[model samples]
Target: MRYGTRALLSKALLSLLLMAACGAQAHFQELIPSTDILTAETGNTLALSLKFTHPMEQGPVMSMAAPRRFGVMGPRGQEDLIDRLRPGGTDGKRTFQATYRAELPGDYIFFVEPAPYWEPAEGVMIVHYTKVIVDAFGAEQGWDQEIGLPVEIIPLVRPYGLWTGNLFRGIVKQDGKPVPFAAVEVEWRNDGSVTPPSDPYITQVVKTDANGVFSYAMPRSGWWGFAALLEGDTPLKSPDGDSVPVEAGALMWVQVRDMR
Candidate 1:
């Protein structure tokens, strides 16, 4: 084999790997509810959609496996609702859906611990601890409670009942401690009405302040997701039996409505 040929092949592999890493960074694990606020008109049975995808891009979705845990922290207590999840997807991409019946008129914080996803391109195992909140019967208690995820975003502001342009704040935590200077990626779940003029418009980036808190003022009225990723304390073994890095993300979802 010629040395020049080997060098060209190596450069090609590096380029391919960089492209894959950028693509994977755009992917987000989404856990959005049918409605952020539940009322009698909407009924007590709430439906939830769980998908791993680029919220802004919308179509380049990745398949998601059954989560390690899925449940809610209601006003009464934490309830394990994993059994309610059913297999689902779009265009053959795997996903999950579940229905939860709210018996109380209080805030229900729904959360999911996704199975670690292997990204050969990025060469890292990704796990997103995602959550969303639904206020039932106008009782807003328990929206601020943390579910103790490996990485979590504790909302500093009320996650629901917001109009477009309202500023949202949260603290990024890993292993129950503040992660100062954490990088957070924010995206608006596109409804096909908006087109990204360029790649940079698809996702927004923000960094936490000295106190591990980050703020973003949502300009559009729709579902918005924020993901703060950090390296896991321990590495995980890859399918090839080699040690690889683990990326843990603390994610939360919120909805904003146009002031009409």
Candidate 2:
């Protein structure tokens, strides 16, 4: 093998790796509900959509397998909704969807534990525990209930019915305990009206304080996703038959409304 040929090959490989890393920067597990706060006028049944993607970019959606677990935790208790998920998609991309009737007036916290995704570019498996809270008929009780996920964001403020400028706050928890100084990445779901000026503007980031709590006031009205990332304690087998670290994320989606 000629030295010049080897050098060219190495440069090409480096370019490809850099591109992959940039693509993985804003990966988010989205568990978005039709309406964050449900009312009689809004509708009786709530619809939820689950997907993995770069929310702000809103394209190049990564394929998602059937979730490992899906359910809701409410005033009554946790209910297993794994069987309720149905295949859904848009523009030929795979996604999951579910519908539930708001039987009682209370807060319904919907969550999904997605199957591990193998990312060869990053050389790690990604699994995100994602959730969203829906308040039914103004019964705000149980919005703060912890569902005992492997990783999660327990909201400090009411998760639903917020004005655009309200401060959204939460505590990053893993194994039901606070993760002090955890890092959180925030992104707005772009609806084609706004274009990011640069890669950094696509995803905003913040760090938890000593108490494992963080806050961000959304300036716009729409769905905002917060992902608190943690390195998994255990490694998973990769496609290449090697052990690789896992990137476990605690993700929660909240919606803000514009004042009339």
Best candidate (score: TM-score) = 1
Per-candidate TM equals: 0.90, 0.90
Task: Supply the TM-score for candidate 1.
Answer: 0.90
Give candidate 2 regions above 4 Å deviation: 1-24
The global C-alpha lDDT for each of the candidates, from Candidate 1 onward, is 0.88, 0.86
Model 2, 110-141: lDDT tens per residue?
99999999988677788999989999998889
For every candidate, C-alpha RMSD to the true structure in Å: 6.2, 6.8
What digit string (tens of lDDT, one per residue) describes model 1 on residues 1-260? Answer: 89999767754554454345444547688999999988989889888999998889887788987899999999879999999999987879999999988998999999999988888878778888999999999988899999998899999999999999999999999989999987788999999989999877887889999999999999999999998877776768888988777778899999999999
Cα error, candidate 1, residue 64 (Å)? 1.3
Clashes of 1: 0
Candidate 1 has an lDDT of 0.88
